[model samples]
Target: MENEVQRPLADFPVNIWEDIFTSFSNSDLGSDKLKEKHITLKETVKESFMASRANPIENIKFIDTLCRLGVSYHFEKDITDKLEKSFDCLDFNQKIRQERCDLYTVGIVFQVFRQFGFKLSADVFNKFKDEDGKFKAHLVADARGMLTLYEAAQWSTPGEDILDEALAFSNAHLEEISSRSSPHLAIRIKNALKHPFHKGISRIETRKFISYYEAEEKCDSTLLEFAKIDFNLLQMLYRHELACVTRWLPEAPNGIPDSMKHLYRTIIDFYDKLEDELEKQGRSGCGFHLKKSLKSTSNGYMQEVNWLKKDYTAKFDEYKENAILSSAYYAIMGVTFVGMGEVAKLDAFEWLSSHPKIRTAAEIICRFTDDITSYDFEHKREHVATGIDCYMKQFCVSKELAVHGLFNIVSNAWKELNQELMRPHSFLFPFLMRILNLSRIIDVVYRYEDAYTHPEFLKEHIVSLLIENIPI
Candidate 1:
């Protein structure tokens, strides 16, 4: 590779995480008594969850709690079966419908269904609007209701004008009520506004929700204790995973530049193993798609580099088209499906290549979220034109409006992502979850700033998830 062009240099911070995971290993967190207690509490929670099925409202709330506590993996099949039944039944669709329920209950059901990819109409919220097409002013007094609607609205798909209105209504009112609410509700609103649970990382959001759930008047002791135990156990596994990953890290070759070798080798080594395994499975053709995605992503990056080198700004449509690959969502998704075993056959890779709405949504999320937040900082350098830049110059708008416009694109992507998850023909739910989880990471990495460049914002989250232990 010969690059005669002089490139821009960035003075990135030193690695704060150098050898930090060395302190973690399975031996340190071992406690037989805690394990036994975890087993007991898990059974207790399971029984309670199963028995709660008698009440429609209570059952949905129970499901929400389990997920929010980050303990749903323990009873994934149980919850899935229940949701499956509910999905199959017309009654379940209407069981917790907004028309028959208050704003809070309706919001809960909407969010839970959307999160799991259940099809529910956004029209149910239409009744809440007054004849004048505005949310009833009186409803603003219902802080809990407002908060729930705000969370529920995050799942809105394209062309859902009412949901768009609902979003604006809830956002404005939540800001208004935050100052006057009780300490607990105020904190919940603040956190939701800063980091929406629907779009937030699973462990990070669950950690915050567990504390809030513990304070609820209806909180069950058994469930609370189980969540705490499950969190600690998972924390150990995360630590162990980190340690294992660090131990086997390949030494980059001296022949390649230091900056390029690390990432280049990591990708090559991972795909090499993946291709080898697929050959064993006699699905070697799957490797072709993997390579295809990898090549496309590299091409996208190269295209961006060329743009910066030539100081050329791409048209808005051109930028978005290239971003599909540049976002690296497709490349990541290729390997994400590898973990599905036989289910990830050759045609599954073909399906991914088709540019499904869900895939496009995830890519948009990755691109726009980073662009909107990091553009100013990046613009200060010899950066390629970001989506924000393309949109701004194309439309000749102020930076603030451009940011807001790009955010609408991000929001629509979320809606499409939510919509795709509910489709009947979608791949095994786990595959879609890979996309969701990856999208969630965008919020974590670029919520207020690009935490990758500014490590300070990310340090606390890394510590919370991997290093700090949840209290027993």
Candidate 2:
């Protein structure tokens, strides 16, 4: 091999400084004390769930609170059972037609059912429409109702014209209402406008909602306190995870290329720590397999580098096959695997290894979305051929047509993801949720641009979830 001249490959600057992580501390978070408090709060919340089960309305509201507080995962069975029972007792169609049923309640029910994978017709909103078949214009005055409707609208699927219209109607009204609403309501509205609850990360949404919930006049102190304690404790756990990564980075294998060492160490250390935790809980071997998966992921990056060196534009299928490995989707699944039962963990790994349609859909959505948004900036520098380049060259289409085609691909990927999520799969639901959440992240990060590459877009979420604590 000829000695190549050393050259700077790209001008990508580090957007986040090291000091940001250095300043994080769990001392104030009081992990041990918070854990104790969290347990007591969990019991209280559980009791609340039990008590509300007899009262359908109260149970629904409580379920909404659990979701908004981001602690729904902690009580998934309880929520599922309650919602299933509630659905059986109250015919959703009949409830929506009742003269007494308000928009807020109907919206909440619609959203909750869809969120948990229960099929609900968008036509339930028909009663709220007038002769012209438009949502009642007078409904805009009820900001909370409009907000809830707007959120429910996000669950729309292809050809759901009612939901599409509902979204447009609710959005315009909410924007107008938010501008004149009280400070507290305005904050919630602004957050919703920026990132719909359906699309927001659960942990981040929980952090934001705790504050919003507290400001409500009817906020349950016990629930509010539980949310805060639980969030801080999780923050403590995350801080410890990052600390482990920092400690392990310098100890990575020397053979790893300098360019890839940091990422390799971070993912490996994360797997190691998670494995240790899972082992303590009697789940073993997941970490080892996850590490193997990480290696496969890294090889995907190496494959891209080789292609770039050869000035190769891969076939679309070839690009997709490699893109799935490089998308970091496996890493997300690996982290979520920790603490899962051995059967579930092994099953998840099996499904992941096979590159199931759901996982492939998520990766395709992520890769194409990223490439489409970032191609311009990437093209200005030394970069591997992206999906955009592959598709354009393979199809011999104009950039505009290629981009349009890519959007269609992303849409089809979403449909696949939705279909996979709709029915029982080989893996547990929670494991599947990790894949869904990863896809949702792509939706947020690549909504208009690549937010991950441009860190400023994610800074507010980071600050809210980590740097700042909610005032009790």
TM-score of each: 0.91, 0.83
lDDT of 1 by residue, 1-472 (tens): 5866566777777889889897687795758998999999999888888884565766777888888999888998888778777767777667656366878888887888777777678877877889998888888988999998999888887778888898899998798799999888899999899888888899988888888988889888888988888888888888887788787765533355556546766777777878988989977788888988998998899899789878999988999999888988899888888877887889888988887778899999889999988887887768898998889889999888989998888878888888788868467677788888998998779868989788888888888888888786
The backbone clash count of each candidate, in order, is: 0, 0
Best-fitting candidate, measured by lDDT?
1
**With candidate 2 superimposed using the best TM-score fit, by how many Å does residue 372's alpha carbon deviate from the native?**
3.1
Q: Write down the lDDT of every candidate, Cα atoms only.
A: 0.83, 0.79
RMSD of 1: 2.9
lDDT of each residue in 1-472, candidate 2, tens digit only: 4885554366565868465665555574465666788899999988878873444766777788899998887888888887777666656457666878889988888888878876677777988899998889889888888999998887776667888799889987788899889999999988888888887788898888988998899989998899888887777667666666676766766565555677678767867887797677666666677888789789899999899889899988899889888877776666666535665555567667777777788888888888889888788877888888888889999889889999988877875676566545555677778888888888888877777778877888788776666654
Off by over 4 Å in 1: 1-5, 52-54, 84-100, 254-270, 281-283, 339-343
For model 1 the local lDDT of residue 395 reads 90
